[model samples]
Target: MELSPVLLYGEAEGMVRSLQSFPLRDTGSGGWLKQHEYIEKLNMQAILNASAGQEEMIKDLLVTHGKVSSLIRELITVEIWKQKVFPVISQLQDFQPRSTFPLYMVIHHEATIINLLETILYHKDVCESAEDLVLDLIDYCHRKLTLLLSRCSAGEIAGQDRLLPSSASETSSLEELKLQAESLEFDVALKCLSVLRYITDHTDSLPLSITTRLLNTHNLPCVLVELLHSCPWSRRSKGQLQKFESGRWLSVPAEDQQKMTKLDGQVWISLYNLLLRPECQQKYNIDGFTRALISSHRDPHRSAAEPSGATAISQLFVSERTGAPKEGADLRAGSRSLGLHYQREFWEMEGDSEAPGEACVLPQ
Candidate 1:
């Protein structure tokens, strides 16, 4: 006998309910393998239901089952497993597996939950449901963002689509897994930014422990300042500006170059919430390093409004940050005066001819 639609929904809901109380401790390799599949299925169904505008059932299933904390634990568990277990498995001489696809799925598991959380965490209930484990989620996001920044700063990170190379024979090895992690790093960092912003939105109701972890412990405001300094989502490639969008880096035209992308907006909005929120202000330490770093990097002049001569001159002032005047002072008036003075001299000497091509570098 065929089940009615209501029965099917109930059956599906029951499965999730059973999975909710799923044991997290001492789940052996076999158990973890099974757990991986279950999480993947839940994530896939969640996405499909979300797209079909039937998110209520999935939301209730996730919250009622208390799956958020489980997801957090599982995410950290996988990360730890990757760090501790995968390397030893890679070295075992007789451990050839039939397929590396399972291993790949294990690595991709973190991304799946990240995607699901991004979809559902917008609701206040979901955020509240996370409870104290929200601190774990915050730490997880911090690690990813910090890793992204360090890689970028060290000049080790590639463009969004650039993957770590792997030969066919090396597909299932730890080396290949490392490569996959590198490839997923950019997307993961972007998702983390969104998740952090959502958490920031609900900070007023967050537990004191979560607030302490986010503000004092993590110094997320300072971390965000670093992101603004080194924007991971956009970069210069052979003089062309490429922005990460729809999974790959696409060339951005000159007109839209100055526009802030979603990644930038996410960081800035999170910063606004963290630094400006009354509760956050009391918790965060806004010391000299934070103040100077923020003041030094923020460009004051309009990108479009300024003349090329003025723009080039402004960079000199920015680069001279130490000796540069304080943040609120009117450097614009002085810089424009200096720019006009130089423009007149160049015009008088060259008779309105264009300056040398290497005269000034455009902002990337």
Candidate 2:
């Protein structure tokens, strides 16, 4: 059912005003569950408005209420929950629930917020509205893309699992729920790729801190190189090639095997935005390792010919680094330390009580 206009405004206002951190132990609590339902509705409204080319009142309400930073915080909050808390709950001996729907909703909340931001952030105003929290959002995206790279490297991302159980019988065990969460994470990482690209689109207009964090602080160019090498979104199974598109993996025909998926385009576009910009080039230090990585992709002997996108990226990398400073401060270690700090902070907040019971049930 669609939300009425009056109810929509009330939900948007409540979501903005009630934004605060909820501990991992408080997952599925009454208050947190209420926010979950409200966000789900807002996500739907945002999508519908965008698809119909209508005025996005929900987006307006959110920006006008100054809730963009809150949304970013909530995104990171659930991300920490998924990384630190969900596994513990899944392994508890006495923590069985009647159904896994409520827990699934909690896990799905991260996707909802990122999805909403992806739709609205297309407008420059939303990016500006994100303000200083843009750094946190960048960190959140870095965590996801790095996870995607690691999974692809381990060959664990080749399987194409359904994000939700098709039948009631499938949700009976914690193992099945864990698998669903993994599949959902694959999609979430892909969405973050899109969000990062949008942020790259507005680098000139955004704060200098963003450009510094993406280039020097996080070294996303090397991360993206690894991603291009691993290519997580496509894999071969039983001698048939499959590529992930529109939330599912579909078999690709021989004629279309070489076509780049949207996922690939997102990576390529973000690379261009980061590597080709004059401001980013002056700040980015292209060391020997990064130079070699880019050069390898452009090698003619690697394949019969490189993709046009790869050609463009390598050209940009070569041209930008000419006569540029080779030595700069390496913040990779500092970034890792900061990540550890977040993990410790979240782990220390674990409540002694058991996980919350199902407060709001999701209809099948």
Error of 2 at 344 (Å): 44
Clashing pairs in 1: none
Q: Write the per-residue lDDT of candidate 2 for residues 56-131, one digit (tens) a residue.
A: 8777877887777878988888888888888887888999888888888888899899998888886777899989
Model-by-model lDDT, in order?
A: 0.66, 0.72
TM-score of 1: 0.73
The CA lDDT at 343 in model 2 is: 27
lDDT, candidate 2, equals 0.72
List model 1 lDDT by residue over 1-364, tens digit each: 4222322457557656655323434444566666666666666666566555564567678788787777777777766766677777878888877767777776687777787787778667888998988988999999989988888899875544544354636465555666776676568778888899889878877887878899889888778878877887878889998988756888999987876565665665566566545577567665666656554545222354544322333333343344565531454444444444433443343333445222321111
lDDT of 2 at 114: 92
**What TM-score quantifies how close candidate 2 is to the native fold?**
0.79
> Which portions of model 2 miss their true places by more than 4 Å?
1-25, 163-172, 298-308, 320-364
What TM-score against the true fold does each predicted structure earn?
0.73, 0.79
